[model samples]
Target: MTKLISQYTALLDKLDRLDWLVPTLARLSFLAVLFFYFWNSATLKIDGSIFSPSAGAFGQIFPKAAEAVLYDVTQLNIFQRLVIFGGTVAEFVLPVLIVIGLMTRVAALAMIGFVMVQTLVDVTGHGVALGSLFDSAQGLIDQRVMWILLFAILVFKGAGPVSLDALLRKRAT
Candidate 1:
């Protein structure tokens, strides 16, 4: 029994050495699962240029306020428009950074913040349910948590050897 235990421990140690796979897989998964989702969303927010956000963009970011003004984005304050613009830009920029593994940790960290804000907007602005955690795993909260965890992996582990970050580090060294 002791010999069997030792063998199991050794195997587990070997598996642990593959820790680099975590961030690499996380980035790839983000590319596969969410890259286009954000790109498409950002596209929807723009009518012609990012300087001119669509009425739908205001509705999405500030739904109640947009409805209060009947979805006329011009009725919103400068700060509000800036928020919408910043969010739209982030939705495009952060995902690309993560996908390319450039400035990955910072990008992932920003993505976590973005997801949190997006979740808030989804729940409050859009009237989406904030569904309780551990209840059944079908709520916006659960889904966003998983997304955040994927970003968190990139935040902590970094984009692995396959990344532009890795290449830059090598060049610098």
Candidate 2:
């Protein structure tokens, strides 16, 4: 019994020593989603002109409101347009920072906020159905909650030793 307990403790310690594994995997898994969903969207939102979106980018980003405005998002004020652009940029930038583990804690926190706003837009602006939080993955909110949890973990634990943030910390020490 004593030997079995000792071996179990040793195994738990080994797992603890690899604490970086889950956070790194979370960031990497996020990367797969970003490459397809975000980079593609970002590229679509920008054409040859700097900061200028293709004709339909805004309509896609704010579909419901755009329809209310007869699909002319240009009717939005300068500040509103800038907000859209900023959101688009963040959707691209924040995820990249997280993947590289540079300023990962900040990036993850920002991502949490981003996820919240994105979910809000989906729910309020697009009229997406809200599922009960306790209900099994019934709608977009549940899926987003899972994403936020991943970001929250990084926000608390930070990038692990394999990350750029960790490397910089070591050098600074």
Candidate 3:
């Protein structure tokens, strides 16, 4: 039994030495599952031209605010436009940064925030009901919570040796 315990400990240490594993897995998970959702949503916001977001995107992000602005998204003030456009750009940019392991920590942190904001938007924009977190089945929060956990792994462990962040660190050294 002691020999078995020693072998298992060795195996665990070996896995830990593969420092890039967690970050890489997190990146792959996001790429495989969530990338298209973000890309498709961002595509909808754009008008097939640079930085040109549709009114619908604004409405989606800021439903109450959009209503307050009376649906004339084009007539939105500068700050409002900036927020919508920035959010759109972030949806496109941050994921790529995370996948490539460039500024991965910042990207992961931003993505965590993004997930939170997205949940709020889903509740407010689409009027999704807040369900009990202890419920037997999954809810919107449950799905988003899983996403947050994945992002958190990348945030804490970083992109690892296979990533650009690691490459840059090596170069610096």
Give the candidate number with the greatest lDDT: 1
TM-score of 1: 0.94
Query: lDDT tens string, model 2, 14-106?
Result: 999988788888788778765457667777776664377554666666766677787665576677578678877886898788989999999
lDDT of 1 by residue, 62-143 (tens): 8889999999978989988899899999999999999999999999999999999998988777766776765745566887
Off by over 4 Å in 3: 67-70, 134-138
List the candidates ranked by TM-score, beginning with the highest. 1, 3, 2
Pairs clashing in candidate 3?
Answer: none
Candidate 3, position 109, lDDT: 95
Candidate 3, residues 1-173, lDDT tens digits: the string is 99999999999999888866777888988899998888888888877653776778878887887788786767777887787788888889998998899999899999999988888887878787667554626476778888899889988999878889999999999
Positional deviation of residue 143's Cα in model 3 after best superposition, in angstroms: 1.1
**Order of models, best lDDT first:** 1, 3, 2
Cα lDDT listed for each candidate: 0.91, 0.78, 0.84
Candidate 1, run of 10 with poorest lDDT: 131-140
Which stretches in model 1 have alpha-carbon errors above 4 Å? 136-138
State the lDDT at 93 in candidate 1.
96
